[model samples]
Target chain A: MTDATLTRPAFRRGVPPQLIGLGALVAFFLTVELLIQIGVINRFIVPPPSDVIGSFGRVIVEEDVFGRFLLTLSECLIAGVLLTVVGVGGGVLMHRYRLLQQACETWVAAMASAPIVLMYPLFLVIFGRSMWTMIMMGFVAALPPVILKTLEGLSGTRKVLVNVGRSFNLTPSQQFWKILFPAALPTIFVGIRLGLIFALINIVGVEFLINFGGLGQLINELAERYDLPGTYAAICFVILVSILFFMTLEKIERWLRPFD
Target chain B: MLTPANPTTQAAADDAILVVDNIVVRFETPEGPIVAVDDVSLKVKPGEFLSVIGPSGCGKSTLFNVVGGLLSDHQGTVNVAGETISGPHQSIGMVFQEESTFPWRTVTDNVAFPLELTGMPKAQRIERARHFIALVGLDGFENRYPGELSGGMRQRVSLARTLASEPKILLMDEPFAALDEQTRLLLGDKVLQIQQALKQTTLLITHNITEAVQMSDRIVVMTYRPGKVKRIVDIDLPRPRTSEIVGSEAFGRYVAQIWADLREEASRGMRDEEKHTLEHHKGGAS
Candidate 1:
């Protein structure tokens, strides 16, 4: 009963929240553009919306923005998939084994709290400051939340459900896959979404700091050369990528729990 | 009444499906070992509907855990379906409170789960799950996730899942406690209908006296903490218990009988808890 109500998102498809969120986003951007055009803000430094749009277009046509976007996307995807695998796998192991949960608790906490950007240099030393380093950094940052979420999620699974699994003479594996996992899904996805966002941010942040080959790296390169418009364009691209990632994840969350 | 022989030999018997010997359960605390269940014994005859009723912490659940092979430290043995239950046995199916129906699984998948473990092919599992789902009156909602259904509906799914396993014995732990009263009655009757059709041996643990009386052929009233069998009342009510039975004088008599036995145990349990608390406080002050 506690679990049945939890699997669905708080807001439904036709709710006012979605409408309000979209309306606010459009209004906020329009107000900013209007302020820039009316000279309330300095165009020289911040640049107007039109100029930003033009630069974005130029970057798309000349600099192969889609290819670079795909590159960044692929890295995030690889890191996300890897984080899920390692995180869920480790989580289940830890959950099933009480000693492991206790042993990994402090380690997971330390990894979760440590500055992922700082690890970029260490990864760079080891992996030579390539995309692999960025991915690893993302994984390190993302992994703790994923693992923690998995533990919390699995533990949060209703005692009622576990008893049910037991009643059916379910094996440990069967119980986990059928009962525990499903019961803990909403919380698991919360961890996954948090992990995805963390991984994306960390990957780009690492790329920016280490000057690797993603949009973040491009933004850093453009800024150093004082190509302000190009930097602006790359920043826009990053924003778009973040939005796209969020939307895709939201869609996936919906698909996984459709009726909800 | 059938009596199982030696625990090991009991399982190999042809008639009795489950035998729960005197099980003693205790929890180790900093203060001392807290006794939860003390010398509880029961047996499930083939196709018998047995309901155990007691107040909270009466160790009814602990008794179920012993039978389910969950608590090994307990002093007892459980034999299921011609096999000694060393651990969870595939021949015995279990249903828990509504939450056990995995929210992520559609009704079909949830029902098919036990079969999946048994290495049944996908098609056969699906077909079997569908049959069970229909048996539980959840035909159209097979594709719906547990999250999409009501509490009663979800419990039905859990029931379907348990039945889908085709286990010789089915164990339910307060499965209807979370539902509204109306839903509980409906589900209870639905469960009774299924049990009648399948002729499955069932053991249900509940706090609801009326539910125990309405559904069970025999009701085992349990004592409070350090639980023991207080009494066993046989329901003389005829089979295929309908909603109309709830209004019958026979049902009222059963409810009153269970309540009388339970009240004394509940009072005793409360006093035990209070005394323990006071002792803890005095020790702290010293």
Candidate 2:
């Protein structure tokens, strides 16, 4: 039986679905480039892929976009770290204490639905127009999803696994670390990813809104100067940042849970 | 052929490894308080392989849970080797009906978990885990995760983990129910071989009559809920029984007799479930 399964076609075994997705993305970029080169689209409004590709070096050297890129990266890192610590810690506490979860669950859901980004004016007044404002906005915007997802992950742990732990006379802490934490990890990672996404959005949006530091500010400046290629290049950098984080997260997740 | 023994009249031997004194479990649902196990009592001797067989919803699993110390809100006391079990005891290891192997852990790690809790040195625990893993016939698959294995293989991993704890009593709640008949029979033989070799005291709760007949020294037949022991059928068949015993004439007789004792209770359980569903539909319509 094992040999028969191993003998199946390479397409069934070796090729990952991600390769197909990558192909689709490349096709999309090529189509856009083709339209721009044939004059089917206006170059002023939508710069060709070639122009954006060419601007990568110029954006880094002439515009000195690396410093701004690092600033945005640091903001995202700070917010991501805060989300993991606070969100996961809060989830563990809520799971441990039923009444606390019940008391705050509805409030957390309401907060998630609320237009939190609009509260930037209030945050700006409180923290001033420094990087603190952006960090705070990113943290707040990212918090709800993290907390909610953490709670869900912890709660969704299979009861049988917990029972097995209990049967072994495992201490509460031992059970949490050995069984509960590992079992809930995949879902918890999902929460972290969602939180990172929200954090990135809020961090960039806040930068653009206040015309502050980071990639968002760089994009805003390039757009104001009517440097379309440079603006698109900056936008590409934003996407690059997102892709970097996503790839890092995927690697970490695989390392932590190799079987899954 | 083995005949059913009277549990109430049977003397509780001094060498009994586990003693349950009239355990009663009740659960309070929105409907009201319902009795799950009512005054169920049994004594399991050291090195004994006992099987508890009953109708569906007969609270066989509930009784197993009580003995495993997973259910503490019961009325009676469960003593293991003369010590009262208040919570999960280290000497009592349980295998659940559902897949209980940690998906995150490799086979060796899953087996080593109980030892890890006791703060056993990593090298020693892994060594101990490997012994039990090999005992369950999973010699080469030590580093593989449970997700990568078949259902039967995973259950074997669970069994190995439980056995690695070196528990005085093993409580298996339909550990083979999820597997196919062939796998179940094969696993049953493996469990019997382990029990015979180690002299392990085991109590297996299963609905399969043939499994009880093929594997157990004594089969405890239970009635519908509130579950009460109907009879304790002692297998007088020759020991060191294997999968081959299933074809024996004596095995067929034992299986037939257990079905006879359980048939009425099974129908009664079905009737009650039908009535409940009818009432539920009527309530919704009204």
Tens-place lDDT digits, model 1, residues A136-199: 8888899988899899999987776676666556667877877788667778778888898888
Error of 2 at B109 (Å): 0.9
In the predicted model 2, the residue pairs found to clash are none
**Interface RMSD computed for candidate 1 is what?**
2.6
Clashing pairs in 1: A161-B100, A167-B93, A167-B94, A168-B94
Candidate 1 stretches greater than 4 Å from native: A1-22, A33-45, A61-64, A96-100, A167-176, A179-185, A210-212, A225-229, B1-15, B81-83, B272-286
Cα-lDDT of candidate 2: 0.89
Please write out the lDDT profile of model 2 over residues A104-161, one tens digit for every residue. Answer: 9889879877878899999999989899899999999888888888889889999998
* lDDT tens digits, residue span B129-216, model 2: 9999999999999999998999999999999999998999999999999999999999999999899989999999999998888888
